[model samples]
Target: MGAFRGLAAWVVVVGVVFLVQGWLSDGALVFGDDDGLVEYESVETSELMMDAEFGHFLDRKLLQVTGSDRSNTTIRKLVVRGDRRDPTNGFKKYRDGYDVKSSHYWASVVYTGVYGFAIGVAWLLLGALITLLACFRCCCCRRKMPYAPRNRAYFWIPRILAFLLSLFAIGVIITMFIRNRQLHTQAFNIRDSIATSANDATGAVRNVTTTLTTVETLVTKYNIQGLNSGIIGSTVASLNNQSDTITNKVNTNIRTLNRLINGIEIALIVMLSITLFLVAMGMLAALMGWRTVYFLIILLGWLITALTWLLFGLFFAVNNVTTDTCQAFTEYLQAPANTTLDELLPCVDLATAASASNVVKQGVNNIVLQANNALTQIEQVSASLGRPTTLPPVCDPIGAAPDFNFTTCPNGTVLIGGVPQVVAPYVCPSNPVTTACLAQGRFVNSTQEATIKDLSIAGNDLVAIIPTVNALTNCSFVYDTFSKIVNERCPPARKALRNLWISLLLLSIALTLLTVSWIFANHRNKKPHLIHDQEYSPTGTTARVK
Candidate 1:
């Protein structure tokens, strides 16, 4: 029965400790729960839960897409809506191009490591120090007994807490390493894909340029310009120059994008290495004591958790935002009224081409003049030669009132035996009139010549677009393509990275708790002999007080 007294004392001491620990951790001691979510009004719950500082962080990170570091450019500014450059500051950047150059590896691991691991550990360490002071109260007091009175409650409290903390910390560390690796893979893949996309965009530009050149060559080969001075030499020249300009701009933007992505990849690798060092620091603190580790863990935990919350927010934002942006561009491009084709394509604009069109029209009319003069000259020769000369003005353009008498064929054509024959016809011309004449001599029908000349002049409309119109029409596809990239990469990375950071933070907390428990366990037994006034006590034996 005497042996039962020590066991009974231990049971009472442990019971009191269990109750106290439960009360402290549960926040059920008539005190409010800080982390427990509640309700709010007149605002979204997300905003209420997320502080303004967190929103600021989100704003900065999002600014990377719009590149609105200071709102240098956007549609809102161009449109002059109120006094803002961009109502959302997300209206498109990079010379008003829609290109998403980002890497999750850069976004996730660096933030998690610096803010979550290093800073979080440091912050918690401070808190743990205060806890340390409480536990060390007896140590600091001036009680000069040979041995100090032991508090058994401290023993079990820290011991239990430490075991739990160490266990949790281990899981968190493993998760963080794995998460970091995943983000690295995601970043690498995205970088490669972006590189490929840039190459493709260059190809698109080249094809557009090639097509425009083809149209110019076709018109030139058929002598369309020679037929009429009003066709204007500057029109074709402008298209040729514009092609070069758009191509250079596209290539430059692509290079910039690739450079940015590559930089992120390199930075992520370096930051990951640093994260490993931080994990090692947390591990070391864990081994020391709960107070030391928690001091590092708690504060860092809050910071990391906050960042993760913001990441989760961004994960969703990327999905909807990217999709919506693509759709908006689609609508804008498809509708001529909203933004004309010329405004949309840096290559050319048809609405502004009225002057050029009129010039081409005049050139075609001049062909009619040449045709009439050639026919009148032919009839005169036929009458003089006494051939049956009744061919009315051949290929006379309808409603063309000829003001001049028969004259020379200054437009690379001349009268040969009363027939209007091309003196210098289109070289390798594919027009039926020129082709037939080349095959069967210059005695072809007037109608055929008229058709060929009209076709050559009509080629002007095709020149304005050449390779660009089709490519611009296909810009609608870019939105969907980017959406696919965002869906496959950004969202999942955001969540996984957040989880990874959170786990590491929890692990730090557990390590700190374990260390504190170790210290308390040691302190609990420090004065055991003093309590019983015994030089020695048998193993698993507690001598009862008299």
Candidate 2:
């Protein structure tokens, strides 16, 4: 009885301790359920800034396609729509762009942390309950229960339950992680699709522009001017030749750009689908872990569950992945609208050319004189309409070196006695026909030069984006945040659970061995009692009396 009292006192002390532990850990008494769910909303101002920045980024690419940086040159005023003009002022003062939350990795980190905390709190409670139940049965209940012939069952059940629950928790984490990963991958495909489409459009516009400029240049460069009866016969031939060159170049660029766009679109669609499927699978896997009940079937189930949770972090990191998207211009070229072949075609006065040349011999003197004057007047008007040649280079020619003491010329242009003169600037000659030809040639060269410059700049912008984009892809907020939690919250929490599991398993095994030993010890003592009773029967008592 004293032994029983001592055992009961020990059980009470243990029970109180376990109850207190439960309250501190898994119990509802200490912390509220919402303790871990706190998060901050993205600032509206920041979001607007983010949107503007992206718009500028887009505009810069568009400008690049047309041989300009109108977008980037004007970007500072456009995108930075806040009190502080400088980034050095910090994010607090700056308005964010479109998809502000998505743009910042820190947002992802916060989200991951909150998610981990909430889920961890729940799992902590489960562990506490498991520990309490396990401790109670081991210390108190087993002692009072009747010893059945096969009593190992009672000792093993609670341990199995603890192990199974731990495993389930781990699996839930994995599934969520995988789902997040898939979402991130899908976002990448979407971004790529948009970029590819934009690139193709830019290419097409550039190609057509270049072809038109080239055709215009060919007509003007060979001194081909004044199309009339004499030249009219060859004018159509010249136009045809120019047109063929333009057509071939345009067709080649368009075909190439179109093919690239088609391939990218197909690839993006396939990848998006695959990513979605992976997300769904991850979710399904988590659900299965949640519902799993049997530990024996889920060998290493706890580890898998931990991995699942870790995967949730991975998914967050991946989904939050960002990359730079810009227009491709170096791969294409653009020309101005007015530089096309149609614009370069000369306006011919066919009647004047034909009638004057044939009928002037037969006309009256006044009519011939009047027609010549009219022709001269028309020629003056045409020359006036052409680009002016009086501008510097057109009016001046290089003279022989003057006999002077000075020797060197200025950097940009030839100089006499080291004096600076502007280099030969573009100029049109005074001859109406020649001036028209020169104008066309200048227009074509200028347009093509501008187009190539713009395209090349655009290419550089896109390439510059590659490193920044790649950087975004390589770094993950979710992964960083989750890893922090693992080091801080998860690792320790899991270790506690694992230790608890091991202790339970060992306790159960120990109980099982003790029970067997106790039974054997009792059986042997009973056999001795039975033999004594038999030996002390009536016949033996009578023999003792004699």
Candidate 3:
């Protein structure tokens, strides 16, 4: 009986001390914060828009300023500010959802500590009461058995406390499970949005290529003389009207596409909000649950399971969030296809590699060809508007056979003909040989000037390409920077998580010790005869028995 009391005292004191130590030393409470969950948009859409707007201003107004190089500064700053609406909004763009800041972490830790202390005290009190029952049974009760009323009443109190403790452990498990599921679901939705954004980005690039190709072909057809007949003229006019219509359509679609991408960015913010809420709720549930359980072994198992679930949730959450972030940044970064980086980056193959691939290639080719044909009709109209009577040279080819010349005119009023008569001399588009690479079959020296002129015209049509490349470069830089931040912060975040686990582990140990002490105390009280057996020492008559 005395042994049981001694064991109970040790359990009460030791469990209380360990619980207090864990509470005080717990880094989980002090270090855990939701800054990790705050979603960082690797691509700032507003910033990109501002850059694009400023570029537009530079091309249209600032660069044209008479004798004022510094004019760029004023217009550049104005365009940027106009596009941003509120420059401070750029900073606010980062996800600032419900955050578990440093203070929250400390608050959680303090709350848990208080609960742990209460639990420890309750367990110690239970132990002491059990030990008292055991002592009374072995000594005073053996001589004069206590009334059934008193014995029953004493047993009831510990039984109620044990039941309450079990309920608390179960509650913690349930709460943790709920939080885990919520976080997981939120992450999944964000992943879906990422996929959608990626698809939109791909589609936008295809549209750009289609538009550029169509414009190029139409520009070429404008100079083809034979195509300038009356029917062709009307067709060209109709096509010009259609071209204007398509241009508007393209612009509208591009804006719509931008809006779609931005919507996904907002979803990223929502994802962070969900993450923070789940984590905070989890913390609350965990602390509350741990306090409810009285037994050390049961509490320990429950806490371990809860911690495991939390880590598993984080594992998936981190991956989903990281991937979504990457895709989101890439979608905006890769928006422009003609920027330096864009030209350097691998583009989707336009050619077919196999029979199956040919099917898709052929479909896309047909679409591009139709789009170009529409532009050709429009260019013919513009050409006719410039000169109506003398059909553009290619449309008015004179002789049927080779070596035809206008010098053979019978009246001798000869307008002069042949290759030299009709062909316009080629002029190099620019001094740099790099930009004016000769087209196929055209030697560097062969009609170099004429070829260069043609190349310059084609290049001018592709002027939008450069800015697109620059945008991509900026986007990539943003991606790399944010990725580094996430990676660097991950280590400390993981450590904080580990500390949380350790605190739970200690709580479990305390519960197990308390349970063991209670069991022993119960055994001693129920078996007072063992103490009496030792005291009797084989005497003919028991000390309190006949």
Candidate 4:
């Protein structure tokens, strides 16, 4: 009976020891889940989750950051509102509910331009009336008229003044020409800068998509067992669609802006050239005492002058709006949230930004985890078969969750950048005897080595893209572009517009004065001479006493 009890106790002790050993071994196999391996279903689900999260990031965060969502709003629409709210005011109260095209809006933002247009119209009407009266008198009236003596200083005075006025008009036009050229050049520079920025935005997005595609291809080409490349491909297509939408909208707006700017530049060139030619011709006609030519010049000059004033008004308004936009843009950059610029460049909310950033970090970490876990499992299998893994594990590019620092890696891990160097030494040369080579030189078999190399390469690519992704999510890239525009571009553009406006105003005034001088000079030249209370012949052939 003592021997039976002793045997039973021994059996129970052996069985318990075996079970505990099995449990420990199984626990060693379990890294985070029940199975130590990354399953296809889990990977697919992870991909889908990442796709959904990233899609939301692209829609809400990236769209706002890139300014593509508000591409339809022109500069005019951005600035000329009835209730032009101060951008410094909080966004919650002033983000919406304003009339963009109200008469009150136009008058408030561009009242100086409105007045200029009104005055230009009045000048046009007055010039037309004067031109018609002069034409009628010259062609129909045969009545005798008094003439100033040829030797009179006053007669020469008008001629001399007309000459000086012509010279002054020429100076004004030259200044206008210089300002216009500067403005044109500056505008082109700004356009190119904006184009480059748009390209950068799209390129960043493309890089993400392309890298993902490359990863998917690698997974399939290498027949990596754990990942579902199909899921990645589908996600890539969805990302492409979203990126295309943004790219198209931005391109459309850029094209429209290009057309508008080109048209305005052409008009400016034509108008300035015509005005300069007319001024010169009018001066020559007055000097030569050509009544017909002088009359023609006067008519054309009036029309040109009126048009010039109208353009002055238009550019005056443009200058005002430009100044306003600069101020608002500066304010917007300082505090992006709760401003009028939200209508033009909406910012992503904090929660969405945080969530997107988390998703990115988590996605990247999962990819690293998946690769490393697979490598570990392979190492275990090799150990079971009496072959040891020589290759080092793939390093996590990011730290653990909650604070995924790029600079920090988990224990016994190398950074993705340094993995290539660490892995280079373990790759086996061509050899038929895999076990002998692995044992002798601590080299992994060629196939396993290739998998390690591919994973390392993929990790490097992923790490390279992380900064770009972070920039897009946080809007730092877009903010940098805006900063460039405001700090470097806005001052020169605003100055050019202001200078152009002043030059236009001066030219208009100078042309108006020159027209008056020419009219006076022409009247003086055509006046008939009368002697001693006698009427001069209608034909100016002889004077007869009346």
Which 10-residue window of candidate 2 scores lowest in summed lDDT? 324-333
Q: Which regions in candidate 4 have their CA more than 4 angstroms from the true location?
A: 1-111, 131-142, 146-151, 220-227, 336-360, 370-394, 401-405, 409-412, 417-447, 529-533, 536-546
Taken over the whole model, the C-alpha lDDT of each candidate is 0.40, 0.30, 0.34, 0.61
Across 1-546, the per-residue lDDT of candidate 4 in tens digits comes to 999985675565445433533453233221123311111111112232212422211101111222454456532223222233232343111222222334444444454365468778999889778768877987899465565345566566777788767766766666667777888888777667666766776677688778867766665565443335765565566556645655675577568768977888889888888887887787777677788888778778888888888888888777766666665554445544444443333333334444434544665676577566655665675566576665466667677778877765558766654654664544557645367556654345567666766766666776787787676566665566666776677778877886777667767877888878888888777665555577545454556664
- lDDT (tens digit, per residue) of candidate 3 on 20-113: 4446434223321442222222222213322352131111111111225544442211101111111134322222211123232223222323
Q: After superposition, how far is residue 523 of candidate 1 from its true place, in Å?
A: 6.2
In the range 1-546, model 1's lDDT, one tens digit per residue, is 888984675455445433433343234222113321111111112232322421211101111223455265433211101111121334221123222332322232123223234444554566567667766875786343344334445445655554444444444444455655675566556445444544454455445445434544544444654433223445545544554555565556556646754664465345434433443444444444445454455345434434333433343233223232333333332232223112222333343233333433344355455455555654564455454344434332222323212233344342222232341232233444464544433333455455445443443333333223433433423433343444465545444443443444444444445444544543443443444353334353555545
Q: Highest lDDT, which number?
A: 4
What's the C-alpha lDDT at position 440 in model 4?
A: 51
Residues forming the 10-long window of minimal summed lDDT in candidate 3: 76-85
- State model 2's lDDT: 0.30
Best model number under TM-score: 4
For model 1, the stretches where C-alpha displacement exceeds 4 angstroms are 1-164, 188-195, 214-218, 221-468, 494-498, 501-546
Worst 10 residues of 4 by lDDT: 56-65
For model 2, residues 1-546, the per-residue Cα lDDT tens digits are 999985675565445434433443342221114422221111221222212321211112212212244334321111111221222334343333212223332443334333434443544455457558868987888543222233444434433443333233223223223322443344344334333433433333233234323323432232222312244234333334433443454455445545644553354345334433433333343333432322222222222333333333433222222111101110011211111111111111233222222211111122222223333443454457574332111111112222111123334432111111121122222333354645553222344333333332322222223222222222222122222332233323332332232222222232223223322332222211223223333333312212
Candidate 3: count of backbone clashes, pairs at least 3 residues apart or interchain: 15
Query: Which residue ranges in model 3 land beyond 4 Å of their true spot?
Result: 1-29, 32-157, 206-526, 529-546
